[model samples]
Target: MSNNAIIFISVALILSALSFAMDRQKTIAGFKRGWQMFSRMLLPFLNILIIVSVVLYLISPDDIQHYLGAGSGLLGFAIAAVVGSITLIPAFISYPIAAGLLQQGASYAVVGTFMTTLMMVGVVTLPLEIKYLGRQAAVIRNVLNFFAAIAIGLLIGVIL
Candidate 1:
C-alpha cells in the first residue's frame, strides 16, 4: 500500500482505540451501528459492482477508446458528464473504474469529468436534495457543479 494509505489507516486505528478507551459502551454501540449500516448497503454495493464489471467486460477497450478517448473530444465529455450525473456508484468503486477506463485508453478529460460529475452533480439524489435544501438551491448547486466538472476535466486534460 502507499504511504498515505498506511498513514490514514494508522490514524483511523488510533482514533478508534482512543474512542474505545474513552467510552467502551458507546464505542461498541457505534461499531454496531456502523456494521448495521454497512450491512444495509452491502447488497446495493454488490449489485453496482457486478453491473459495472459486466458492462466493462462486455464493452471492449477499443470501443471505450473510440468513444471516450482523446479523439472523441467535446461529444465524449458531454456523454461522460451525463452518465456520471445519473450513476450512483460509491467513490471507493468509482475510482477503480475510472482508473481502469484510463488504462483502457479513455481520455483524461473524460474520466475526470465523469469522476467530478459523479461526485458533485448527483442527478439520482436530486429529489432528496431538493426536499432537504429546497428546489432552487439544489438546482443551482447541480447546474454550477455540472459546469465546474467540465472545466475541471478540461484543466486536467491540459495539465496532464
Candidate 2:
C-alpha cells in the first residue's frame, strides 16, 4: 500500500477510536449509518470495478498506445474525455489506471483530459444533479466542465 493510504487508515482508526471513547452509543449509531450507506453503494462499486477490469483485460496496451498515445492528438483527448465523463470509477482506482496508461505510452494530454473529466463532469450522476440542482444549472455546469477539461488537457500537452 502507498504511504498516503497508510496515513489515511491510521488517521481514520484514531478518529474512530476517539469517537467511540467519547460516546459509545453515538459511535455505534454512526458506524451503523455509515455501513448502511456503504452497503447501498457496494453493488454499483463492484459493477464499476468489474467493468474496469474487463476493459483493461480486453484492450491491450498496444491498442491503448495506438489510440491514446502522443500521435493520436485531439481525437484521443476527446475520446478520453467522453469516456471519463461517463464512467464512475472512484479516484483512488482511476489514478493508478491513468498512471498505468501513461506508462504504457498514452499521452499526458489524453490522460489529463480523462482525469479532469472523470472528476468534474459526472455524466452518470446527471440525473441526480439535475434533481437536486435544477436541470438548467446541471446542464450548464457539465457543459462548462467539458470545455474546461479540453483546455486543461491542451495546456498540459503544451507545457509537458
Per candidate, the number of residue pairs that clash is: 0, 0
Off by over 4 Å in 1: 127-137
State each model's CA lDDT, in order. 0.93, 0.90
Candidate 2 collision pairs:
none
Q: Which digits, one per residue and each the tens of the lDDT, describe model 1 over residues 25-66?
A: 999999999999999988977887788778888999999999
Scored by lDDT, model 2 comes in at 0.90
TM-score of each: 0.84, 0.78
